[model samples]
Target: MKHLLNLLAAIALLVWGTQLVRTGVLRVFGANLRSLLARSMGNRFSAALSGIGVTALVQSSTATALMTSSFVGQGLISLPAALAVMRGADVGTALMAVLFSTDLSWLSPLFIFVGVVMYMARQDTTTGRVGRVFIGLGLILLALRLVVETSEPLLASPVVRTLLGSVSSDLVAELLVGAALAVISYSSLAIVLLIAAMAASHVVPTEVALGLVLGANLGSGLLAILTTLKASVEVRQVTWGNMVFKVLGVALVAPLIGLWLRHAHPRLGDIATSVVLFHLAYNVVISLGFIGMTQWVASLMARLMPPADPASKNPLRPRHLDPSALATPSLAISCAAREALHQADLVEAMLVGMYTVIRTGDLKLSAELRQIDDSVDELYSAIKYYLTKISRSELDEREGRRWTDIIGFTINMEQIGDIIERVLIDIEDKKIKRGFRFSEAGMQEITELHGRLVDNLRLAMSVFLNGDVRDARRLLEEKVRFRDLERSYAAAHLARLSDRTVPSIETSSLHIDLLSELKRINSLLCSMAYPILEPTGTLAPSRLQDAAPARPQS
Candidate 1:
C-alpha cells in the first residue's frame, strides 16, 4: 500500500507539473507566438526557423502547429509555407530533450520567486507575465526531476524490473513502450527526457531508449489529428501530412536500430547527453530529407482528404469546450475567447454588407448580406452554447468575470443580428414596395458612417483578443465620435425635411430610415467594445486597471 501510494503521488505530481508548464509558459505566450509566426511567414526558410525557435521556447509543438494551422485556415500563410513550419517545429521540439538532460532543475525555485514577483507585482506588464511563465516552467521541471528520483527505486524491485525490462531487448517491445510513454506525456520531448534518465541509470538499454524516441515521434501526431478534428478538410490534410511524415520516419528508422547504434554520430558526456544527440539527429534528418517532398506530400493529402464542403465552412462551433479543455480552465477560456472574437468579426462584417446593400439599392448585394447575417447568427448561437457549458466549471474569480463579459457580449451581438433581420431587412422590403430611393449624398453619408462603425468593431475585437485595455478605451472614444456623427447626420436630414423644394417623398423617407438604422448599428458596435475596453460595462476608470475587468458589469 505504501509503494502504491508513492506511485500515485509521483503520477499526480507529473500531471500537475505538466499542467503548470502548459498553462503558464505555453498559453501565456500563445498570442505573441502566433504573431511571431504570422510576421515571419513570407518564405519557407524563415517560416521554418520561426516555427522551430518558437516551439523550442514554448516547449509544445502542438501549440505551434495549431497556430500555424489557424493561419493557414485564414489564408495568412500558404499551404507550403505552413508545412515547412510544421517540419521545423518537429526539430525544435527535440530541444526539450536537451532541456531535461541539463542540470537546470536547481533553478526551479528561483523561477517560482521571479514568476510570483512578475505575476503579482507587475500584472499590467507583458514582462511580468513572461516572468510568471518562466517561474511555472522552472517549478514544473523541478517537480519532474524529483518524481523521477523518487520513482528510481521502483527499478530495483524484481517485479518492477520484470514488468519494465522484459522487452528492452525486443524491438517491437521497445517500440510499444516508447509509444505508450509518448501518449502518457502527449509530448515526445518529455518522453525523450524520461528515456534519457532511465538509460543513464542503466534501467533501460540504449537501443530500447532509441526505440522509445521513435515511438514518441509517432505519438505527437495524436494531437495534430485531434486539433484538425473540427477544422476544414485542408486542415485535416495538413494533419495527415504530419502523421505520414512521422510514421514513415519511424518505420524507416526504427527498423535500422542496429545501424544507428553502430554508425550514428557519437556523443560526449553521459547517456542522457547521447540520447539528446540521437533525438536531435533523428528530427534533423527527417526535416532535411523531407524538405523536397513537401509539395508531393501536400498533393497526396489533398487527394486523400479533398476539400471541405462549402456549407460546412459556414460558422464556428467550438469543440474546445470539451472535457479535455475544461481540465485546464485557463486554456479553455483563451480558446473560447478566440471563438467569440471570430463570431463578433462576422457580425461586424455582416453589418457592413447590410449597409452597402441598403445604400446602393442592390438586390444581389442585399441577398449576399442576408446570407452573411444568417451565418453570423449560427456562430453566435454556437459560441453562446459553448460558453454556457464553460460557466458550469470551477473557474478562478478573474476567469469567472471574463466568462460573464463574453456571455454578455455574445448576447448583445445576437441582438444586433435580430435588429438586422427585423429592422434593416424591412427597410429593403419597403424600398422594393415603395420604390424608395436615397439621395446620392445620403448614400455616401450612410456608407461612410457604416465604415466608421465597422472600424470601431474591428478595433474592439482586436482589444478583446489582445486584452489591451488602452485599445479598448480608444474604441470607446470612437464610439463617442460615432454618436456625434449620428446627431449631425440626422440634423442635416431634418434641415432638408424643412425645405419647401425638398427631394421626392420616396427619397426623403428612404434617407430617414437609413440614417436611423445606421445610428442603431453604430450604437451596437460601440456596445460590443464596451465590455472588452471596460469590463465593468463603463469606460475604463484608470490606466492602472489594465487587467481585463475582474467582475461582470450590471
Candidate 2:
C-alpha cells in the first residue's frame, strides 16, 4: 500500500511539473511563440514544422492545438493548414517522450538548485520565469526517478506479479490502461515516461508497454477534444480532425504490434529503449502518411461539425475565454486580452457608422447603429465576468499588472460605446428631428476630426496589444494634438457664429456638442497609453508644463 501510494504521488508530481513548465514557458514567450506559429503558415510543410517546434518547446500538443485552432477561428489560417500543424504537434510529443526516456538523473538536482536561486532573486522578471521552467524540468526528472525507484519494490510482491501477468498477453486491455493513464495524468508524455520506467523495472512487458504507448497517443487526442468541448465550432473541428487521425492510426497499428515486438524487441537491447523507439516510430509513420491528407480530413471535419449560422443573434458570446485556461493565469490573461480586442473592433464599427449617420442625416441608419451598441455591451459584460473568474492568488506581479491593464482598457472601450450612443441620440433628437445642418465649414471640421479620432483609436489598440513604448509615447503626443485641434475647431465655429453665418448660427448648439463629445471619445481611446507608459517610466507626472503662481483674488 505504501509503494502504491508513492507511485501515485510520483505520478501526480509528474503532472504538476508538466503544467508548471507549460505555463512558465507561455508566460515568458507566449506572444513570440504565437507570432512564430502565425508567420510560419506560408505553406503546409512550414506550418507543420512550426507546430512541431512550438509543441516541443511548450511540451504539450494540447497547447499547440489551442493555438492553431484560435488562428483558424480568427480566419487567419485555413482549416487544412491547421490540421497539418497538429500532425507535426503529435510528432513533437513523441520526440519529447523519447528524449525524456533517456538517463538524465544527474541534472535534476543541478536544475532545481539554479532554478531556485534565479527565481528567488527576481521573481517578476523574465529571468525568473525562465527559472520556473528549469524548476519544472528538474521536478520532471526527479519524478521519473522516483517512479522507477518505487516500482522496483513492487517486483517482489506476488500480487503485482499476478496483475502484470494478467495483462502481458492482453494487448487491448494494456492499451486501454495506457489511454486511461494519459487522460488521468493530463499529459501523454508523463504516461509514456511512466510506462518506460515500469517496463525497465520488469513490472510490464515490452509488448505491453508498446500497446500502452499507442493508448497514450489516443488518449492525448481525446484530451484535446475534451479540453475544447466548449470552444467555437472551428476550434472543435480542429480537435475532432486530430482525434480522427489518432483513432485511425491506433486501429491500423494494433494488429501489427505483436509481429513488430517479436522481431524488434531483441535488437533494442532493453525494454525501455524498445518502448520509446516504438512510440517514436509510430508517430513518424503517422505524420508522414497523413501529411497530405489534411485537406480531406478538414473537409470531413467541417461536414461533421458545420459552421455556426452567420446570422446567429448571440454573436456577442465570448469566443476565446476557455474555462480550462483559467487554471493557467497567463493563458487566461491572453484570452481576456484577445476578447478585449474583439470589443475594440465592435467599437470601431460603431464609430465608423456614426460618421455616415451624421453625413446622411438618416434617422433609420441612426436607429440601426444604436442596436449595434447592444452587441458591444454584451461583449463588455462577458469580458468583465471572465476576467473576474481568474484567481488573483495565482497571478504574479507582472501578470497582476496586466490583468489591471486589460480591465482598464475594456472599461474605456465600454465607455466609448456609451458616449457614441449618446452622440447618436443627440443627433437624432437635436439635429435630425429639427432638420438642422451645419455650414459647409462646420461640416468639414467635423469630418477631419472624426477621421483623426478613428486613426487614434486604431493606434491605441495597437499599443494595447503590443505594448510598444514608442507607440504609447506617440499616442500621448496625439492626445495633445487632438486637444489642440478640438480647441481650434471650437474657436473656428464661434468665429463663424460671430459673422452671423445663418447655417452655423442655426446649428450652433449641435455643432459644439458634437465636437466636445468627439474630443471626449478621443480622450477615452488614448487612455490605453497610460498603463503601458507608466510601467516603463516614459509617462510624465503631469501633461502640463510649469505654470505661473496663482494671483490673489480681488
Candidate 3:
C-alpha cells in the first residue's frame, strides 16, 4: 500500500510539472508563438515545422491543437494548414519523449535551486515565469527518477511479475493499458517516459512497450478531441481530423509491431532506447505519410461538420470568444479584438439604418432595429467574460495595456448601441408618433450629420484595428469638427425658430435631441483614438486649448 501511494504521488507530480511548463512557457512567449504560427502558414511544410517547434516548447500537443484551432476559428488560417500543423505536433511530442529519456538526474537539483531563487526574487516578472519553467523541469526529472525507483520494488513481487508477463503476451491489452495511462497522466511524453523506465527495469518488455507507445499516441489524439468538445464546429473539425490521422497511423503500424520486435529489438542494445526509437520512428512515418492528405481530411471533416449558418440567432454562442485562447494572453486579446470588430460591425449597421428609420418615421423599422441591440449587448458580455479569463499577471506591460484597450473599446461600443436604441425610440415616440417633421434645412442638417457619423465610425474601427497614430489623430480632429458642426447646426435651428418657422417650432424638442444624440455617437466613436495617441504624447490635455485666448496679455 505504501509503495502504491508513492507511485501514485510520483505520477501526480509529473502531471503537475507538465502543467507548470505549459503555463509558464505560454505566459512568457505566447504572443511570439502565435505570430510564429501565423507567419509560417505560407505553406503546409512550414506550418508543420512551426507546429513541431511550438509544441516542443510548450510540452503538449494539446496546446498546439487549441492554438491552431483558434487560428482556424478566427479565419486566420485554412483548415488544411491547421490539420498539417497538428500532424507535426504529433512528431514533436515523440521528439520530446526521445529527449527526456536521457538520464538528467544530475541537473534536477540544480534547476530547482536556481528556479527557487529566481521565483523568490521576482515572482511577477517574465524572469520569474522562466523560473517557474525551470522548477517544472526539475520536478519532471525528479518524478521520473522516483517512478523508476518505486517500480524496482514492485518488480520484485511475484504477483507484479505475473501481471507484467501477462501484459507482454497480449498486445491488445497492453495497448489499452498504455492509452489509459496517457489519458490518466494527461501527457503522452510522461507516459512514454514511464514506459521507457519500466522497460529498462525489465518490468515490461520492449515489445509490450512499443504497443503501449502506439496507444499513448492514440490517447493524445483522444485527449485533443475531448479538450475541444465545447469549441466551435470548425475547431472540433481540426481536432477530429487529427484524431483520424492518429487512428490511421495506429492501424497501419499495429500489424508491424510483432515483426519489428523480432527483427529490430536485437539491434538496439538498450530496451529503453529501442522503445524511444520506435516511438520516434512511428510518429515520423505518420507525419510524412499524412502531410499531403491534410487537405482531403479537412474536406472530409467539413463534410462531416458543415459550417454553422451565419444568420443563426444563437445569442449565447460567441463567434470569437474561443475559451482555448485564454491560455495565451496575446491570442485571447486577438480573439477579443476580432469580437470587438464584430460588435463594431453591428453598431455600424444600426447607425446606417438610423437615418432611414428617423427620416421616414417608420416605427416598425425602429422596433426591428432594437433587436440588434440585444446582439450588441450579448457580445459585450461575452467579451468581458472572456477577457476576465486572461491572467493579467501573465501579460507584459504592452499586452496589459492592450487588454485595457480592448475592454474600453468594447464598453464604448456597448454604450453606443444603447445610445442608438434610445435615439430610435425618441424618433418613434417624440417625432414620428406625434406627427412632427423638421424643416427642410433642419432635415438636411441631420442627414449630413448622420452621414459623417457613419464615416467616422468606419474610421474609428480602422484606428482600433491598426492603432495607426496618423489615423488616430485624424479621428481626433474629426471629433472637434463634429462638435463644431453640432453647435453650428443647433444655433441654425434656433435662428429658424426665432424666425417663426412652422416646421422648426413644431419639431423643436425632437430636432435638438436628434442633434445631441448624433454628437454623442460621434464622441464615442472618436474615443478609440485616445489609447493610441495618449501613449505617444501626441494627444493634448484638452482640445479647448487651441481655442483659448492668446497669452499676449501676459
Candidate 4:
C-alpha cells in the first residue's frame, strides 16, 4: 500500500509539473505564441511547424488546440490551416515523449535549485516566469524517476500481478484504459510518461505499452472535441478533422502491433525505450502521411458541422470571456483583456453617436447613444465578474499586475459610459429641446475638439493594448495640448459673447459645457497611459512643478 501510494504521488507530481510548465510558458509567451500561430498559418506546412514549436514550448497540445481554434472562431485562420496545426501539435507531443524517456535525472536537482533562486529573486518579472518553467521541468524529471523506482515494488504483490495479468494478453482493454487515463488527466504527455515508467518496471509488455500509447493519442483528439463542443462550428471543424486523423491512425496501427513486435523488438533494446520509440514512430507516420490530407478532411468536417445560424449570435454577448480558461491564469488574463477591448469598442460607438447628436442637434440620436452606453455597462460588468473568479493563488507577480491593469481599464470604461450618457442628456435638455443654435465659430470649436477626442480614444486603446512607452508619452503630451485647446476655445467663446453675437448668446451654456465634457473624456482616455509611464520615470509624480523660492528681492 505504501508503494502504491508513492506511485500515485509520483504520478500526481508529474501532472502538477506538466501544469506548471503549461501555465508558466503561457504567462511568459502566450500572446507571442498566439501571434506566431496566427502569422504562420499562411500555409499548412508552416502552420504545422508552428503547432509543433508552440506545443513543444507549452508542453500541452490541448493548450495549442484551444489557442489555434480561437483564431478559427475569429476567422483569423482557415479550417484547413488549423487542422494542419493540430497535426503538428500531435507530432510535437510525440517528440517530447521521446525526449523525456531518456536518462536526464542528473539535471533534476540542478534545475530545481537554480529555478528556485531565479523565481524568488524576480517574482514579478519575465525572469520569474522563465524560472517557473525550469522548476516544472525539474519536477517532471524527478517524478518520472520516482515513479519507476516505486512502481517496481508493486510488481511483487499478487493483487497487482493479477491485475496486470488480466490485461497482459488483451490489447483492446489496454487501449481503452490508456484512453481513459489520458482523458481523465487532461494531458497525454503525462500519461505517456507514466506508461513509459510502468513499461520500464516490466509491469506491462512492450506490445501492451504501445497499445496504450496509441490510445493516449486517441484520447487527446477526444479531449479537443469535448472541449470545444460549445465553441463555434469553425472551431469544431478543426477538432473533428484532427479526430479523424487520430482515429484512422489508431485503426491502422493497432493491427500492425504484432508484426512490429516481431521485427522491431530486438533493435529497440529495453522495453521503456521501445515504448517511447513506438510512440514517436506512430505520430511521425501519421503526421507525414496525413499532412497532405488536411484539406480533404477539412471539407469533410465542414460538411459534418455546418456554420452556425447568423441569428444565433447575440451582438452584446461576450466573445472572449471563456469560462474554461479560468483554470489557467494567463489564458484567463487574455480572455479578460480581449473582452475589455470589446467593451472599448462599445464605448467608441457611444463617442461617435454623441458627436452626431451634438453636430446635428438631433434629439433622437441621444436615445440610441444611451442604449449603446447600456451595452458598455453590461460588458464592463461581465468582464469584472469574470476576472473576479480567477484565484489569487494562481497569479504570479507579473500576472497580478496585469490583472489589476485590466480591472482598472474596465472601471475607466464604465465611468466613460456614464459620462457619455450625461453628455447626451445635457445636449437634449440645454440645446436641442430649448431650440438653440451655436455661432459658426462655436460650432467649429466643438467639431474640432470632438474629432481630436475620437482620434485620442483610438490612440488610448492602442496604448492600453500594446503598452508602448513612446505612445504613452505621446498620449500624455496630447492631454496637455487638449487642456490648452479647451482653455483657448473657451476664451474665444467669451470674446464672441462680449461682441453680443446672437448665436453665442443663445447657446453659451451648452457650448461651454460641451467643451468641458469632451476634456473630461480625453482625460479619462489618457489615464491608461499613466500606468504605462510611471514605471519608466518619464512622467512626473506630481504635475505641479516645484515652486522655486522667490529670488532674493532683498
TM-scores for candidates 1 onward, in order: 0.69, 0.80, 0.87, 0.83
Top-TM-score candidate index: 3
Sort by lDDT, top down from the best: 3, 4, 2, 1
Model 4, 283: alpha-carbon shift in Å? 1.5
lDDT (Cα) of model 1? 0.68
> lDDT for each of the candidates?
0.68, 0.86, 0.87, 0.86
Q: lDDT tens string, model 2, 1-554?
A: 99999988998888888887887887788777888888988888898899889889888988888778877776778898998899899888888878888899899999899988988999878888889999999999999999999999988999988988888788788878888888888889889888998899887877788888999998888888887787778878988998888888887778888878778878888778888888888887778888888999999998889998878836566667765555446667988999999889888988999999899898888887788788788888888898998877557777798899999998898889999999999988888888888899999999999999999999999998999989988888988999999999999999998999998998898899999999999999888888888868876688577896889999
When sorted by TM-score, best at the front, the candidate numbers are 3, 4, 2, 1
Indicate the worst ten consecutive residues by lDDT in candidate 2.
322-331
Winner on lDDT (3 vs 4): 3
Off by over 4 Å in 4: 23-43, 117-131, 156-173, 205-208, 266-269, 308-342, 382-406, 430-445, 465-471, 484-513, 543-554
User: For model 1, how does the per-residue alpha-carbon lDDT over 1-554 read when each residue is reduced to its tens digit?
Assistant: 46547655654555455455655554356556767888887777788899799877767676666666656555567777778888889888886667667878778888887878877886545555576566657656765676567556766778867876678777777767777766676666666766776677666778877877777777777766775686666556666787788877777666676776776625354777877777887788778788667788888887888786667753544432333333334545666777777677767767777776675667777676667667667767776766665533335446766787677676767777767665556766777556676656566777788788778778766766675777767776786788788778877777766663234345666566666776676676666566664545565566685777689789
- Taking all chains together, the TM-score of candidate 3 against the true structure is 0.87
lDDT (Cα, tens digit) per residue for candidate 3, span 419-518 = 9999898888888888888899999999999999999999999998999999999999999999999999999999999999999999899899989989
> Model 1, poorest ten-residue lDDT window?
319-328
Quote the positional error of residue 461 for candidate 2 in Å: 4.2
Q: List the residue pairs that clash in candidate 1.
A: none
